[model samples]
Target: MTPIRHNHSDGDAVLDAVRDCVLAVGVRRTTMTDVARRAGVSRMTLYRRWPDVRSLVGDLMTREWVAAATDAMPERRPGTLTRDLIADGLVAGVAAFRAHPLFHKIVDVDPELLLPYVLDRRGASQEALLALLADVLREGHADGSVRQGHVERQARALLLIVQSFALSLRTMTDADDTELNGDAFLAELRGILERTLTP
Candidate 1:
């Protein structure tokens, strides 16, 4: 992909600038002035697009994440939710969050910022995650890997596990514990799902 340039004509360029500002100075310290400087756009132009930093960051993520999900998520296998969850889905999902400075900034500064992105009432990240889980569960059920029960409930439970794992990054960073034992967590999570959902 072509690196977005610093220009007003390109919305992605502005987002790229704002993302850079967040990375360089963190969320709170980054200001419109910094974004303008990084973007090579006039301050007036930046203000016209976004009244504040939160708004700019919010807009960028809201637009970007769905695309990332569809593009990066693994193809659905026939009957193995656990395999998909462990193999590619979880890794891609976490990698997406780790790669985005906006996610890190929000989680690092205040977990509440995750509310709009992950906890909104509509098709928020949680809902999107549930949909992803439901797809895998459907395949699993078809192939006899998943028990026939309330798929929605099971999907919601699975989504919460993933969401909490991602949100826990804040606490993990605060404790300065960077070594994430992904395998251990996956094993624990899978056990929980199997206990709850298996026939």
Candidate 2:
């Protein structure tokens, strides 16, 4: 039989606990016991929901990352163009993620945790983002703001571009440099998205 999933509040508690534990101990050391203790749930409760720390952490990452992306998206105004919205949203999303404490911690301490999502397969959060992007791209298509194409293809392509910048941008940055910088690359990202989507 399949195990029951956490209800809204209970899931939040568990995921929030997972976040705290991972933030403090890193994914390498965090365990189901740690999450259960932090969440004030029984080990059996956590075990029913998630078999291991990595699975629990995966769910936590989905929750936190999706929330970050939603919060980072600009509220669309009556006159706002979709391409503009997409460009601004992508740039803001990248900045928000880079600044996120959880993201920073994982990247700094448990970088390999992300390798599966990066090199192997799309995570729940990524699949969610792709669906949202496809819908938004459909809107842009209706408005003639986005170039006409297979919506899924366009959405995946856009995600690929943003993912690279959001995930790997730090490797190419030098804060002290004047010519090449994070901000400069972000601007370039904006231009690329705008041009890619603009009809």
Candidate 3:
């Protein structure tokens, strides 16, 4: 897929508008006009860039996912353990998604909007996540910490694992559940990932 180019400030404003609008009124009710008004841009500007709300929202979601991944990326340091880096990155990524106001709002209010990406169709967000994980796994492989395997397959599996945690965490735990709180869950997830990737 070709990346859309926009002025950084304008693109941020547009994405921020979409996030706010989705959180405020749900995806189905968020119109291009609404986004334009919130972004302080005319509808024509949005129309020229994106054909409809779905396309615009797709870009918005991709931007958010990339930002979260980039922010969560681990710093490379000498003697750093690959599993530690993976665990830290996954924890940070999941935390970012959990902390996003629009994320929970979408899950609670308009889950169908996410079904296409979750089901058979792979979205740009998923592709970006796969690429990020692949790069990390490649580094681990070069360091002889990760098992030799298909990098793409490993990356996809990791993406699915993390995505499940990010999107369905509420379904997996309850307020009264003691064993599956955030920290405990992350610890277990880290252990699982460490085992999975170890040579």
Candidate 4:
């Protein structure tokens, strides 16, 4: 499949520059002038598109997150259980977040900027994720694989669980006594989802 592109022409370049800048010096220190210079666009052009670095970073995060979620979606099969499909998608989504080169940088360097999306009420990224999962749950309901319930509620619960796991990785213990590695954690999460969805 052709790769999904979030921005148009120079916008793409600008977001790329923003990503590079954020990774290099963090969100606080990345300047519009620096992004303009890196993107080979005039400062005036950058200003026309974004009023400040925070807005620019918000757009960048949205674009990157949409792309990541799109790429992480699992292929739907006729007889697949709803829980299994959601579990697979969650695993892929979490893996995408984990594998992103800038994820750790943002978490370690500019976590405050990300707190609104993860800690507080729903943000653009969270809304997008909920919509995606809602669609999946709706499909499962149509196919008789999902229980009869409020799809939005199910979607919200799924999103919260997956988001918690993804954002709380740094806080997870790595003690040898606890099996909290990627595979084990995902397996546990999958089982939990299965039980939650079972009717």
- The best candidate by TM-score is 2
lDDT of 2 by residue, 1-199 (tens): 0112345799899999999998898999998888999999999998898999999989988887777777777888889988888788889889888889999999999999899988999999999888878888998999999999999999999999999999999878876768644888899999999989988
lDDT of 4 by residue, 112-146 (tens): 99888766667777777778788878867876766
Which portions of model 2 miss their true places by more than 4 Å? 1-8, 179-181
Q: List pairs with backbone clashes in candidate 2.
A: none
lDDT for each residue of candidate 3 in 4-119, tens digit (9 for 90 to 100): 34467887889889988988998899999999999999999999989999888889888887777777767867789776688778877887888887777878888888889778
lDDT of each: 0.63, 0.87, 0.82, 0.80
Candidate 4 regions with alpha-carbon error over 4 angstroms: 1-8, 177-181
Model 4 clash pairs? none
- In angstroms, give how far residue 84 of model 2 lies from its true place: 0.9
- Model 3 residue 55 CA deviation (Å) reads 1.5
Candidate 4 has a TM-score of: 0.89
**RMSD per model, one decimal:** 5.7, 4.8, 3.5, 2.4
What order do you get sorting by lDDT, best first? 2, 3, 4, 1
Q: Tell me the TM-score of each prediction against the true structure.
A: 0.63, 0.93, 0.90, 0.89
Q: Clashes in candidate 1: how many?
A: 0
